[model samples]
Target chain A: MTTPEPDRLFTPPPLMTSPALTPPGLTPPPPTPPNGVPLPYQAAPPPTTGPSRAPVVALSALAAVFALVAGLFTALYLGERTDRDTIASTRADQERTLANVTGRQEQADATLETNRSRESTLTTQHDLLTQCVEAAKGYFALPPGQTPESSRLFRVMYDVCPQI
Target chain B: MTDHVLSIPSPPAPPRPRSRVAVVLLSLLVVLLLGASVLTIVLFVGAKEEHGLEVQRLDRTSRSLTDAEGRLAETEQTNDTVTDRIATLEAANAELHKCADPAKESIIAARSDDEEALRPAVRRAAENC
Candidate 1:
């Protein structure tokens, strides 16, 4: 009949045991407060398995950039190699053409020399023939019925064409 | 502890990573490329020098050929001149031969006087013997 003891305060459910948000089979780890004491009013900390390695990820990204640069350089080097090969072959071709031109020039020189010698021979023959004709003229002009005074005409004729 | 807890909310970003091996390799590659470029430059210079030398040789050859051609032309001209002279002389010689051969009447006339005087004497001498 008298007033009962003040009703006990309504108790709130613990955060770790709340099934409305937490995944199944996963339990929250014990809380580690700054003072190393568990507080009754706060939720527990989430579990952490091992140390993080963010530096290694950053280093891997840097390495990938370096590799990209090196690959570009290699491509440039290959292009240079092809250019060098093309230049070398062109130089060889030019040298071959020069050699051929020189050879032809030498042949032309030889032909020119032969022609000169032939011309000299013809000049000599012409001179001898002229002398023969002059001597024959002189012989014919002698007094009528007189024999030639000397063998000069005969000598000139024979010298004109030794075979003749 | 208070300072560390306060520092956790805004920690400095991690320092940029540097690859020492890659830097060294890049330096070496640059040096190698520079050396190769120098060598190529020297080769190009040498090739240019060779080209200049070949050009000089060709120029000399051209001059020589020109001179030879001139001489050949001169010789041909001389040969032609001589040939023409020879033909004219031969024609003159043929005319001289035509003139030198006397007519048969002239030859007979030259010897007929002596032969006529001897014919009457020979008959008079034979009758006495």
Candidate 2:
């Protein structure tokens, strides 16, 4: 009926008496494996990330190509727009200059025409003056204040003279 | 007799149609490229036309400028002619001013006895306008 001394000393280990050091207002973890209950905790296996290389590479390549093409189109569009603006500005200036020149040219032409007409008139007048001077050159004379016969001759000459 | 009815298996279901996303993306890219190209072309053509018109106008302006220069030169020549005519007129005016005064003086002196009596009338006649 007597038990071995080693069996008597092999008593179960003492249970933890200290309270868990959990923060205030937080629920403490359920008492781990109450007494001899089997543990439910286990390390999770490594996550199985599937193969994604091809699709990712394809999408990235597509995005890059699209961006490049779009950028090129934008650049071309900007260049053309700028070129048009510059050309239009230059043309506008030219048009304005042309308008001014046309006005000035018209004025000059009118002045020239007037000068020509005036000259023609002057030439005709000069010819008439010359005829009058020639007709009166030597014979033109005024008689003494009182002379009936001389007055008669002067009146006759005046009536007959073509250049007066 | 077991007849083996080897009916041609209906052609394997046509290969599944491509995903809508892939088709839509490709179509969008094509449409975008085409639209951009069209826009660029329109701009290019417009700019070219404006440039051509500008060139034509510039040429016309140059021709007009040349004509103006020639006209100006002709006007200068006309001005020279007018200046010569003016000089002629001035000479004529001077001659009128000199008036045959000495000849009139001789005639008056010869009529010395009547000089006093006819002085007013003769003086008036002798003075040129």
Candidate 3:
């Protein structure tokens, strides 16, 4: 298997400093590169066909990240600010509405007090009327010949106040 | 065309594998950015939640205010009814005064076998005996 068959040969690519094309005693291969790695090209420079990069791409990605984060933070900030403002506005509205309610409550309290006072006065009047009715009954209860002073007293009691 | 013979030599071993620190850094940074993005999304959602709670609170307050308004109207109606009752009582009190007036009693007494004109309550309480 060391030698190829006569039909076909598959040629392999060469290493960077290989000497297959060079004569055996022509000279030692050129000195190795100072870094011990071989030069990428024996003539001219590396092919311009593969990926090429600078740190700018990473920086650009980082800048894009910053922009995205900043945009998001700004959006959140504005949204929260708007919500807080709405809450403040709503609270003001509630306060105003509550003030009206408080005013109505005050009016209701006044009306209630007036009603209570009226009820108290009515109770007093009712008591007086009851006393008048009792006095009228007593006046009518005077016997067949009551004293003149008693008659005058009975008349005064029943005449001045009426209760029904 | 010329027939040029080509000699093949062994290919060099693949270049030594390089450090992947830059890829790792970019991956870690992307992960960090994704995390920040998630947190930003949460903050946005939290804002909506706060507003939602505000809306619910306002709705509750509105309901409470409606209830209070209804109660106030009921109280006002009650006041009107009581006021009307008081007015009726005042009118009744005025009418009772005419019956109970003692100055007219003398005229009624002088009349003969009198009291057909008197209300039942006055006749019942009259001292004819």
**Each candidate's DockQ score against the native complex?**
0.04, 0.07, 0.11
Rate residue A118 of model 2 by lDDT: 66
| Tens digits of lDDT, candidate 3, B30-90 | 6677777777777777777787777778777777777777777777787777777677656
Cα deviation of A60, candidate 1, in Å: 21
* Candidate 2 backbone collisions, by pair: none
On the 0 to 100 scale, the lDDT of residue A126 in model 2 is 52
Q: Is candidate 1 or candidate 2 better by TM-score?
A: 2
- Residues B17-52 of candidate 2 have per-residue lDDT tens digits of 443455557657666766666676676667667766
**All candidates: TM-score:** 0.38, 0.45, 0.47
What is the C-alpha lDDT profile of model 1 across A1-164, one tens digit per residue? 23223474323447654665577686545433344334444333334332334544555555555555555555555555555555556556655655665565566556556665655665564555445445545544444454555356535443442321
Please tell me the interface RMSD, in Å, for model 2: 10.8
Go through the candidates in order and give the C-alpha RMSD of each one to the true structure: 14.1, 15.5, 12.3
Candidate chain B TM-scores, in order: 0.65, 0.54, 0.51
